[model samples]
Target: MEKLVIGLVQTHDDAEAAAERVIDCGYTRQEVSLLMTEATRDRCFPSPDVAPPSSTFGAAVAMSVVVPDLGFVVAGPLAAVVASAVGAGITGGLREILITAGVPRHWAERYQAGVRQGGILVSVFARSERDVGLLHLVLDDPHMTSFHTEAHRHHAYDTSF
Candidate 1:
């Protein structure tokens, strides 16, 4: 995998809707993890087996997609989501958030540059009538080959999630 794109969707009323938006953006139903505020502390996963707590925010779902080539075609939806989620597109706060979420600073910079150079965005994160918090996005470093190899190894043996 060249990049691991992670997106976080927080909604106050309809967690399901936010989840559906992620699904609509091309991620499968299984790829998205729905976490309620009560089931987690600060949206972090404590353990693999622990269930999330109930939150007044309703739910915070995390979804991811791995891009092997790091091409524009594969990153279209993600770019769109980032563009829409952050009002100023890929600059200012959104750029900072991506870096904070584990996307290497260099990769984030390149992504922004690509967008600025005229890349087409197909779809963005779905907006809801209810309060929707920051839609965080991260693009992991492409130079890390060992993690991809391990993931491939596990993927070959285990198809269940």
Candidate 2:
């Protein structure tokens, strides 16, 4: 069954490492997404003076987006969900994005608050139990608080971004 495996990390350093490991676990860059505040991105990420932007998050699927209501910086396939939320006329896109991705509304609210409070979200979509398990293992890595899933449902319609 297809699933969206997700977890939260307290620090940006942990977020970066966990995301790299997600890629190392054999999931395509296209399958991963990250959401954090712009402040978190600025504080944790290296400046352009140090190295090319793509090197930090990998070149294949790295992008920086600015979403209002919380100044979110979204990267990877989940950006599609944000766009869908916007296209649907919702404000404060993150919570809606999480819900539209099949997360329950209550959990989505908490996740939205979590991100606002400086937690980084790491998420991946997988169609196989193997891939989902691999993601769970990564999310259970050091510094991960816990993980959640929305299995076999694509509430966002087109999760292929």
RMSD of each: 17.7, 4.7
Instruction: Give one digit per residue, the lDDT tens place, for model 1 in 1-161.
Output: 11233322222223334345555545554443331222222233233234345431122222222221222222233433333434443345434534543456754454334333332111223233121122221111133232222222111111111
Candidate models: Cα lDDT each: 0.32, 0.67
User: Candidate 1: TM-score?
Assistant: 0.25
Q: What are the clash counts of all predictions, listed in order?
A: 4, 0
lDDT by residue for model 2 over 1-161, one digit each (tens)? Answer: 45677777776557667777888987766666788888877666665466355554633223466786647888887777787788887775678777777777876887788787778887887667666666667765454434334431222222333
Off by over 4 Å in 1: 1-3, 6-26, 29-93, 120-161
Q: For candidate 2, what is the TM-score? A: 0.76
Error of 2 at 14 (Å): 1.1
